[model samples]
Target: MTTNLTPAKTSANTVSADEGLFKPGSKLKHKKSGGFYRVVMLANIEANLAPAYVYESLQNQNFWIRPQAEMEDGRFELVSE
Candidate 1:
Protein backbone atom coordinates (compact mmCIF):
# COMPACT_ATOMS: atom_id res chain seq x y z
CA MET A 1 0.00 0.00 0.00
CA THR A 2 1.07 3.58 -0.60
CA THR A 3 0.80 6.43 1.84
CA ASN A 4 0.78 9.63 -0.11
CA LEU A 5 3.13 11.65 2.06
CA THR A 6 3.28 14.22 -0.69
CA PRO A 7 0.30 15.93 -2.18
CA ALA A 8 -1.46 14.36 -5.14
CA LYS A 9 -2.51 16.36 -8.16
CA THR A 10 -5.99 15.70 -9.44
CA SER A 11 -7.64 16.53 -12.76
CA ALA A 12 -9.26 19.48 -11.05
CA ASN A 13 -5.78 20.90 -10.31
CA THR A 14 -6.20 20.18 -6.62
CA VAL A 15 -4.11 18.08 -4.28
CA SER A 16 -5.28 15.66 -1.56
CA ALA A 17 -3.61 17.05 1.56
CA ASP A 18 -5.10 14.74 4.14
CA GLU A 19 -3.07 11.94 5.77
CA GLY A 20 -5.28 9.15 4.54
CA LEU A 21 -4.78 5.85 2.72
CA PHE A 22 -4.43 5.81 -1.05
CA LYS A 23 -4.26 2.04 -1.36
CA PRO A 24 -6.94 -0.63 -1.04
CA GLY A 25 -7.29 -2.87 2.02
CA SER A 26 -5.58 -0.16 4.01
CA LYS A 27 -6.48 0.13 7.67
CA LEU A 28 -7.59 3.62 8.56
CA LYS A 29 -8.02 4.51 12.21
CA HIS A 30 -9.97 7.42 13.55
CA LYS A 31 -10.22 8.60 17.16
CA LYS A 32 -12.77 10.91 18.64
CA SER A 33 -11.09 13.82 20.33
CA GLY A 34 -12.90 16.90 21.50
CA GLY A 35 -15.32 17.86 18.77
CA PHE A 36 -13.64 16.31 15.74
CA TYR A 37 -12.18 12.96 14.70
CA ARG A 38 -8.55 12.24 13.98
CA VAL A 39 -7.86 10.02 10.97
CA VAL A 40 -4.79 7.81 10.91
CA MET A 41 -3.60 5.59 8.08
CA LEU A 42 -2.04 2.29 9.12
CA ALA A 43 0.96 0.74 7.42
CA ASN A 44 0.68 -1.96 4.76
CA ILE A 45 -3.04 -1.48 4.46
CA GLU A 46 -2.07 0.01 1.16
CA ALA A 47 -1.26 -3.47 -0.06
CA ASN A 48 -4.75 -4.66 0.77
CA LEU A 49 -6.72 -1.93 -0.93
CA ALA A 50 -6.37 -1.02 -4.57
CA PRO A 51 -5.72 2.58 -5.49
CA ALA A 52 -8.71 2.66 -7.83
CA TYR A 53 -11.01 1.46 -5.06
CA VAL A 54 -9.86 3.71 -2.18
CA TYR A 55 -12.11 6.61 -3.01
CA GLU A 56 -15.05 4.34 -3.73
CA SER A 57 -14.98 2.98 -0.19
CA LEU A 58 -13.92 6.20 1.48
CA GLN A 59 -17.43 7.09 2.51
CA ASN A 60 -18.81 3.59 2.75
CA GLN A 61 -19.66 2.54 6.29
CA ASN A 62 -19.25 -1.15 5.54
CA PHE A 63 -15.75 -0.37 4.32
CA TRP A 64 -14.61 1.61 7.35
CA ILE A 65 -12.53 -1.02 9.11
CA ARG A 66 -10.10 -0.02 11.83
CA PRO A 67 -7.74 -1.78 14.24
CA GLN A 68 -6.69 -1.19 17.83
CA ALA A 69 -3.85 1.22 18.53
CA GLU A 70 -2.66 3.79 21.02
CA MET A 71 -4.51 7.10 20.79
CA GLU A 72 -2.61 10.32 20.26
CA ASP A 73 -3.14 13.67 18.48
CA GLY A 74 -4.55 11.11 16.00
CA ARG A 75 -1.53 11.12 13.64
CA PHE A 76 1.00 8.28 13.54
CA GLU A 77 3.39 6.56 11.16
CA LEU A 78 2.31 3.35 9.42
CA VAL A 79 4.39 0.23 10.04
CA SER A 80 4.59 -1.41 6.63
CA GLU A 81 6.96 -4.33 6.81
Candidate 2:
Protein backbone atom coordinates (compact mmCIF):
# COMPACT_ATOMS: atom_id res chain seq x y z
CA MET A 1 0.00 0.00 0.00
CA THR A 2 1.16 3.48 -0.79
CA THR A 3 0.51 6.45 1.44
CA ASN A 4 0.78 10.09 0.55
CA LEU A 5 1.84 12.55 3.19
CA THR A 6 -0.13 15.70 2.68
CA PRO A 7 0.62 18.78 4.67
CA ALA A 8 -1.45 19.21 7.79
CA LYS A 9 -4.22 21.76 7.54
CA THR A 10 -4.48 24.37 10.25
CA SER A 11 -7.45 26.28 11.60
CA ALA A 12 -6.66 28.94 9.01
CA ASN A 13 -6.84 26.35 6.22
CA THR A 14 -3.21 26.80 5.34
CA VAL A 15 -0.83 23.89 4.78
CA SER A 16 1.69 23.47 7.53
CA ALA A 17 5.36 23.18 6.69
CA ASP A 18 6.11 20.78 9.51
CA GLU A 19 6.18 17.73 7.26
CA GLY A 20 9.47 18.77 5.64
CA LEU A 21 10.92 16.45 2.98
CA PHE A 22 10.36 13.01 4.46
CA LYS A 23 6.80 12.35 3.40
CA PRO A 24 5.11 9.00 3.30
CA GLY A 25 6.04 7.02 0.14
CA SER A 26 9.33 8.86 -0.15
CA LYS A 27 12.37 6.67 -0.67
CA LEU A 28 15.55 7.32 1.25
CA LYS A 29 19.05 5.93 1.61
CA HIS A 30 20.95 5.54 4.86
CA LYS A 31 24.21 7.44 4.73
CA LYS A 32 26.13 4.97 6.86
CA SER A 33 24.56 1.61 6.04
CA GLY A 34 23.69 2.40 2.43
CA GLY A 35 20.38 0.66 2.86
CA PHE A 36 17.23 1.82 1.14
CA TYR A 37 14.01 2.64 2.93
CA ARG A 38 10.57 3.95 2.30
CA VAL A 39 8.81 6.33 4.60
CA VAL A 40 5.60 4.99 6.11
CA MET A 41 4.37 7.90 8.17
CA LEU A 42 5.12 10.64 10.63
CA ALA A 43 4.28 10.15 14.26
CA ASN A 44 4.74 11.75 17.63
CA ILE A 45 5.93 10.05 20.76
CA GLU A 46 3.00 9.68 23.15
CA ALA A 47 4.87 10.72 26.26
CA ASN A 48 6.87 13.70 25.02
CA LEU A 49 5.25 14.44 21.63
CA ALA A 50 8.59 14.26 19.92
CA PRO A 51 8.25 14.02 16.15
CA ALA A 52 9.50 10.86 14.43
CA TYR A 53 9.60 9.17 11.08
CA VAL A 54 8.17 5.69 10.59
CA TYR A 55 9.90 3.88 7.77
CA GLU A 56 10.43 0.38 6.44
CA SER A 57 13.52 -1.23 5.03
CA LEU A 58 13.28 -1.88 1.35
CA GLN A 59 15.45 -4.95 1.62
CA ASN A 60 13.95 -6.73 4.61
CA GLN A 61 10.67 -4.85 5.08
CA ASN A 62 11.45 -4.22 8.74
CA PHE A 63 9.88 -1.13 10.20
CA TRP A 64 11.86 1.40 12.16
CA ILE A 65 11.25 4.74 13.78
CA ARG A 66 13.73 7.49 14.40
CA PRO A 67 13.46 10.93 15.88
CA GLN A 68 12.80 13.61 13.30
CA ALA A 69 15.84 15.54 14.39
CA GLU A 70 18.07 12.53 14.03
CA MET A 71 16.60 11.50 10.69
CA GLU A 72 17.35 14.93 9.31
CA ASP A 73 20.78 15.19 10.87
CA GLY A 74 22.72 14.00 7.79
CA ARG A 75 21.90 10.37 8.47
CA PHE A 76 19.58 9.76 5.50
CA GLU A 77 19.36 11.15 2.03
CA LEU A 78 16.35 11.32 -0.23
CA VAL A 79 16.53 8.71 -2.95
CA SER A 80 13.19 9.26 -4.63
CA GLU A 81 9.86 10.89 -4.12
Candidate 3:
Protein backbone atom coordinates (compact mmCIF):
# COMPACT_ATOMS: atom_id res chain seq x y z
CA MET A 1 0.00 0.00 0.00
CA THR A 2 1.12 3.54 -0.72
CA THR A 3 0.27 6.68 1.18
CA ASN A 4 0.26 10.21 -0.15
CA LEU A 5 0.92 13.45 1.69
CA THR A 6 0.70 17.05 0.62
CA PRO A 7 1.91 20.31 2.09
CA ALA A 8 -0.65 22.87 3.12
CA LYS A 9 -0.75 25.99 1.00
CA THR A 10 0.16 29.21 2.72
CA SER A 11 -2.53 31.86 2.76
CA ALA A 12 -3.74 34.79 4.77
CA ASN A 13 -5.51 32.51 7.20
CA THR A 14 -2.48 30.31 7.53
CA VAL A 15 -0.21 33.29 8.17
CA SER A 16 -2.57 34.67 10.76
CA ALA A 17 -2.91 31.24 12.29
CA ASP A 18 0.80 31.31 13.00
CA GLU A 19 0.33 34.43 15.02
CA GLY A 20 -1.43 34.38 18.35
CA LEU A 21 -4.57 36.38 18.99
CA PHE A 22 -3.00 37.72 22.14
CA LYS A 23 0.28 39.47 22.84
CA PRO A 24 2.67 39.40 25.70
CA GLY A 25 2.10 41.29 28.96
CA SER A 26 -1.62 41.38 28.34
CA LYS A 27 -4.34 39.94 30.54
CA LEU A 28 -6.09 36.70 29.60
CA LYS A 29 -9.49 35.33 30.52
CA HIS A 30 -10.23 31.88 31.81
CA LYS A 31 -12.37 29.94 29.38
CA LYS A 32 -14.17 26.65 29.12
CA SER A 33 -15.56 25.07 25.98
CA GLY A 34 -19.25 25.70 25.27
CA GLY A 35 -19.33 28.20 28.14
CA PHE A 36 -18.55 31.77 28.98
CA TYR A 37 -15.12 32.93 30.09
CA ARG A 38 -14.09 35.36 32.76
CA VAL A 39 -11.14 37.65 33.24
CA VAL A 40 -8.87 36.29 35.90
CA MET A 41 -6.10 38.84 36.23
CA LEU A 42 -3.65 41.10 34.46
CA ALA A 43 -0.83 39.11 32.92
CA ASN A 44 2.71 40.38 33.29
CA ILE A 45 5.95 39.46 31.56
CA GLU A 46 8.05 39.06 34.63
CA ALA A 47 10.62 36.44 33.78
CA ASN A 48 7.95 33.94 32.79
CA LEU A 49 6.43 34.06 36.24
CA ALA A 50 2.99 35.17 35.17
CA PRO A 51 2.17 32.20 32.95
CA ALA A 52 3.32 29.73 35.58
CA TYR A 53 1.11 31.38 38.15
CA VAL A 54 -1.83 31.45 35.80
CA TYR A 55 -1.34 27.82 34.88
CA GLU A 56 -1.20 26.88 38.54
CA SER A 57 -4.37 28.74 39.32
CA LEU A 58 -6.15 27.16 36.38
CA GLN A 59 -4.95 23.80 37.51
CA ASN A 60 -6.43 24.38 40.92
CA GLN A 61 -9.69 25.14 39.20
CA ASN A 62 -9.55 21.63 37.67
CA PHE A 63 -8.83 22.77 34.15
CA TRP A 64 -6.95 20.37 31.93
CA ILE A 65 -4.83 21.29 28.94
CA ARG A 66 -2.52 19.67 26.46
CA PRO A 67 1.11 20.72 26.30
CA GLN A 68 1.52 24.11 24.61
CA ALA A 69 4.46 26.36 23.91
CA GLU A 70 5.40 28.81 26.60
CA MET A 71 4.40 32.40 25.98
CA GLU A 72 7.18 34.01 23.98
CA ASP A 73 7.16 37.16 26.05
CA GLY A 74 6.68 35.20 29.23
CA ARG A 75 3.18 36.52 29.66
CA PHE A 76 -0.34 35.74 28.64
CA GLU A 77 -2.29 37.89 26.23
CA LEU A 78 -6.03 38.07 26.65
CA VAL A 79 -7.99 35.95 24.18
CA SER A 80 -11.66 36.03 23.32
CA GLU A 81 -13.65 32.99 24.30
Candidate 4:
Protein backbone atom coordinates (compact mmCIF):
# COMPACT_ATOMS: atom_id res chain seq x y z
CA MET A 1 0.00 0.00 0.00
CA THR A 2 2.98 2.19 -0.58
CA THR A 3 1.76 3.70 -3.78
CA ASN A 4 3.04 7.18 -4.37
CA LEU A 5 -0.23 8.26 -5.97
CA THR A 6 -0.21 11.80 -4.64
CA PRO A 7 0.06 14.49 -7.26
CA ALA A 8 -1.02 11.84 -9.76
CA LYS A 9 -4.36 13.40 -10.39
CA THR A 10 -5.68 12.83 -13.84
CA SER A 11 -8.95 12.73 -15.81
CA ALA A 12 -8.04 9.79 -17.93
CA ASN A 13 -10.65 7.25 -19.17
CA THR A 14 -13.50 9.62 -18.39
CA VAL A 15 -13.94 7.47 -15.32
CA SER A 16 -12.01 9.44 -12.79
CA ALA A 17 -9.99 7.88 -10.03
CA ASP A 18 -8.96 11.41 -9.24
CA GLU A 19 -11.13 12.39 -6.31
CA GLY A 20 -10.07 15.98 -6.85
CA LEU A 21 -12.27 16.02 -9.91
CA PHE A 22 -15.37 15.12 -7.96
CA LYS A 23 -17.25 17.98 -6.39
CA PRO A 24 -20.33 18.11 -4.29
CA GLY A 25 -23.51 17.99 -6.36
CA SER A 26 -21.60 16.21 -9.07
CA LYS A 27 -23.02 12.99 -10.44
CA LEU A 28 -21.08 10.07 -11.86
CA LYS A 29 -21.95 6.91 -13.72
CA HIS A 30 -19.94 3.74 -13.87
CA LYS A 31 -19.91 2.39 -17.36
CA LYS A 32 -18.96 -1.14 -16.46
CA SER A 33 -20.68 -1.50 -13.12
CA GLY A 34 -23.80 0.25 -14.27
CA GLY A 35 -23.85 2.09 -10.99
CA PHE A 36 -24.92 5.69 -10.92
CA TYR A 37 -23.75 7.86 -8.08
CA ARG A 38 -23.78 11.42 -6.92
CA VAL A 39 -21.00 13.02 -4.97
CA VAL A 40 -22.27 14.32 -1.66
CA MET A 41 -19.05 15.39 0.00
CA LEU A 42 -15.57 16.58 -0.72
CA ALA A 43 -12.61 14.28 -1.00
CA ASN A 44 -10.84 13.16 2.12
CA ILE A 45 -7.31 12.76 0.97
CA GLU A 46 -5.22 10.39 2.99
CA ALA A 47 -1.73 9.37 2.17
CA ASN A 48 -1.59 9.58 -1.59
CA LEU A 49 -5.27 8.81 -2.10
CA ALA A 50 -8.63 10.34 -1.37
CA PRO A 51 -11.99 8.76 -0.84
CA ALA A 52 -14.97 10.41 -2.37
CA TYR A 53 -18.17 9.86 -0.43
CA VAL A 54 -20.88 9.32 -2.94
CA TYR A 55 -24.55 8.42 -2.92
CA GLU A 56 -25.47 5.42 -4.96
CA SER A 57 -29.00 4.56 -3.96
CA LEU A 58 -31.57 7.31 -3.60
CA GLN A 59 -34.09 4.97 -1.98
CA ASN A 60 -31.74 3.99 0.82
CA GLN A 61 -29.94 7.29 1.06
CA ASN A 62 -26.79 5.30 1.49
CA PHE A 63 -23.32 6.15 0.35
CA TRP A 64 -20.08 4.42 -0.47
CA ILE A 65 -16.59 5.62 0.26
CA ARG A 66 -14.86 5.06 -3.00
CA PRO A 67 -11.12 5.26 -3.20
CA GLN A 68 -9.47 7.04 -6.11
CA ALA A 69 -8.13 3.81 -7.56
CA GLU A 70 -11.51 2.14 -7.53
CA MET A 71 -13.07 5.26 -8.86
CA GLU A 72 -10.63 5.38 -11.71
CA ASP A 73 -11.31 1.76 -12.48
CA GLY A 74 -14.99 2.13 -11.77
CA ARG A 75 -15.36 3.33 -15.31
CA PHE A 76 -17.13 6.41 -14.08
CA GLU A 77 -18.43 9.03 -16.40
CA LEU A 78 -19.39 12.47 -15.27
CA VAL A 79 -23.00 13.30 -15.71
CA SER A 80 -22.95 16.76 -17.17
CA GLU A 81 -25.28 19.30 -15.67
The clash count of every prediction, one per candidate, is 8, 0, 0, 1
Best model number under TM-score: 2
Q: Best lDDT goes to which candidate?
A: 2
What digit string (tens of lDDT, one per residue) describes model 3 on residues 1-81?
222322234443232222334332233544333232222222333443223222323323432221224533534445543
TM-score for predicted model 3 compared with the true structure: 0.21
lDDT of each: 0.31, 0.76, 0.32, 0.55
Quote the lDDT for 41 in model 2. 74
Model 2 Cα lDDT, one tens digit per residue, 1-81 = 554554333433232235656878799999999999988777765566667778899998888978888988999999898
How far in Å is the alpha carbon of 18 misplaced in model 1? 12
What TM-score would each prediction reach against the true structure? Answer: 0.21, 0.76, 0.21, 0.52
Q: Is candidate 1 or candidate 3 better by lDDT?
A: 3
Looking at candidate 1, the ten consecutive residues that score lowest on lDDT are 49-58
For candidate 1, give the lDDT: 0.31
Quote the positional error of residue 47 for candidate 1 in Å.
32
TM-score winner between candidates 1 and 2: 2
